[model samples]
Target: MSLLHTLAMHRAQLPLNALRAFEAAARHLNFTRAAIELCVSQGAVSHQVAQLERRLGTRLFHRLPRGLALTDDGQALVPVLADMFDRVGAVLDQYADGRFRAVLNIGVVGTFATGWLLHRLDGFARACPHIDLRVSTNNNRVDIAAEALDFAIRFGDGAWHGTFAEPLFEASLTPLCAPSIAARLSSPRDLAQESLLRSYRPDEWRRWFEASGSPQPVLRGPVFDSSALMVAAAANGLGVALAPAAMFTRELIAERLVQPFDIAVDAGRYWLTRLLSRKESDAMRSFRHWLLREAEAETPLCSE
Candidate 1:
């Protein structure tokens, strides 16, 4: 018989008590210890383990002079049984108040994750205690289906081919720099001489220049994949960053970074996206509603 079929047959033949006895005995490598743990007599524990071994048609333990040791088959079974028990316990935990604590896996761009979402996570946890939220950060490039993500918060024009995009907020790009850098002579044209920090996107500076009615200068600077890091570089007086001002409000408020001009470009907005084929779950709906409400409170800017 195939190994899978053999294991399946063993599972059918073996009782849970027998499996538990073996697991506890294997863990401690002693029948008396396992008996104490299970609140049963040592003989009962040994009988259960012998029953399990007979059912499997394999000796699971070696009766050593000092105590006990697991055989190769016992070693192989330990982790599998432990994992199954852990999964069962986790599922049981989700049954509180007759509500399942649904798991919601979401991917977020680093910029939003750190600047906005992190601060509000405690509020989300309190409001949706029945939802187990798992967040992973990216750099605006994500594959929802491939990554097994239920939702993704990204920066873009909301035009992905197979996604249902819901706009969160308009993230406008403005020229931001350090206070020392901001002290330079005024005028959008003055950006000609500054070190222009760049994102992987080549057109942000150009767009900002066009929006400010200034000529785009020859770009030469380090490229960054994450806006949070790029903004940090700008805050450290490295170069001028064309970034969203609203997202860096904390840095701006602390005077770590300074915005040089009011002119902003509509590169795109932050969007909550999921695969068009994925049906919305209760957790997904709760998250979307919470996100939209929070985004609205920031300003009535969540797009339809």
Candidate 2:
């Protein structure tokens, strides 16, 4: 049969309810959860799935005692149905106020989201009302392709494999502590007597101490996976945290955390990264231009 003729025949014969049931069930691999999602009973879901299997003339799933598993046919159909549903949802969402809204999905590091991006998002929303921005925050580690992200704002040396990274700005590391701890310290050597909260990066304190003209002390403290959490601990007087001072301006301004010394070290920088193989969409281009302009405005240019 011709492709068009096959599609027409299926269009006439296939039921939309059956397709929806199958898609939901295939995604969850459990008819009960799919039933709850569809607001239908388990029997209803099972009936719809059976109807789809009969019409397609193929067994879509392997029924187990506990749950369900997709056969080759089900696996092939899942992605198509998921994409179709997403497209439908996107179109329906754009119908608000008779304006078409373009959806943009961006992932950012938690520190950047809290300290910088969150504050300036209102401006972006106002400037680009037609773009619907969705954000997800991580701890400077993200898989753009797997997470279905258009862009990922990460902190590193801008050398991630298979990614195109544009430097946003440098974030230097410095010793930040509570006011009480700062009051007790007179010089960089005083840090050795206090608890040093550490992050995953082992060499950060060593580099900071070297920059401060002090010998690196033996660090035996609770390690945090994120700078945001480490700074929080420092603010709460748990220990002194060596973190990026630029990203913790709110805490510093509120006097919750203070930079004890004038010394700082260049650990790495923040970068706006995207998959090298992915083509830039219109929304991506707009966001990139807006981000670069904002970064330039925020950071002072160095004298040549």
Candidate 3:
């Protein structure tokens, strides 16, 4: 056979219904349940799955007295079909209002995502109705290119190589704890008696102590990777968390947490970044503009 003819005969794609039928049956492991889900008769579902097995030259399932069990080959194919169908469905949903809504994917550190961005996303949605957003959160350590993200919001010095960076705001670290714990902390010196919750960054509490001109206390409490979780632990009366006070304003306002001292350590800043080679789409541009404006309203870009 000619090369092109041979390739055509063994192409990857099969009939859509056959794949769908096999996938649904594999999920439920029972023809009746799969039929109910697919709105088809049990006999039809059984026939389709059987036909799929024949076409693939292998038995996809083992007949059990109570239900079906997928073979190794069937196990491998189920997730592939599920992911493909989900992606296809997401794409189809974007076609509305006679135009496709541009999809933008972004990764954000948990602190900024929960403490600041989550509260303002409603405004972003309203302002850009034609743009669809997909957000994933991390612990300030993320690979934007590997994750296939359009942008990433991280906490650092904005000195990452091979990326474009925009400074959002300085998140000065301060001591925060529950109201009960705050009552005992008359001064920075009083923190020596309590547990000191900390993030992976080892120098935050030390810098805050330097800023307050107080002797550094021993930090042997539980270590956390995200500031949000560390503060949550503090709110639960576990310990005193040194974090960005401005980010946890809601907890302070709601009386869940208390900032015990005015001294804050300017250890790092929040930044929006993208890979140098990433091409900006219309959705990306819209989001960038909106995000920059929001950041400016909170902390002006020129304020340093």
All candidates' lDDT scores?
Answer: 0.87, 0.86, 0.85
- After aligning candidate 3 to the native by TM-score, how far in Å is the CA of 207 from where it should be? 1.6
Q: Model 1: which ten-residue window has the lowest total lDDT?
A: 295-304
Instruction: Point out where model 1 deviates above 4 Å.
Output: 15-86, 93-100, 300-304
Can you give the TM-score per candidate against the true fold?
0.75, 0.82, 0.82
Best by lDDT: 1
Please, what are the lDDT tens digits per residue for candidate 1 over residues 1-304? 4433556876766699988898899999999999999999999999999988887778889999999988888888888888888888878867766887888899999988988889999999999998989999999899999999999999888999899999888867888899999999399988888999999998888887888888998988799998888889999999998887877888889999998888887777889999999999999999999999998888521111
lDDT of 3 by residue, 98-201 (tens): 78898899999997888788989999999999998999999988999899899999988999999999988876777889999999999999999999998898
Give the 10-residue window scoring lowest on summed lDDT in candidate 2: 295-304
Off by over 4 Å in 3: 1-13, 53-59, 62-66, 69-80, 96-99, 145-148, 159-163, 254-256, 300-304
**Candidate 2: residue 237 Cα off by (Å):** 0.5
| TM-score of model number 3 | 0.82
Error of 3 at 192 (Å): 1.8
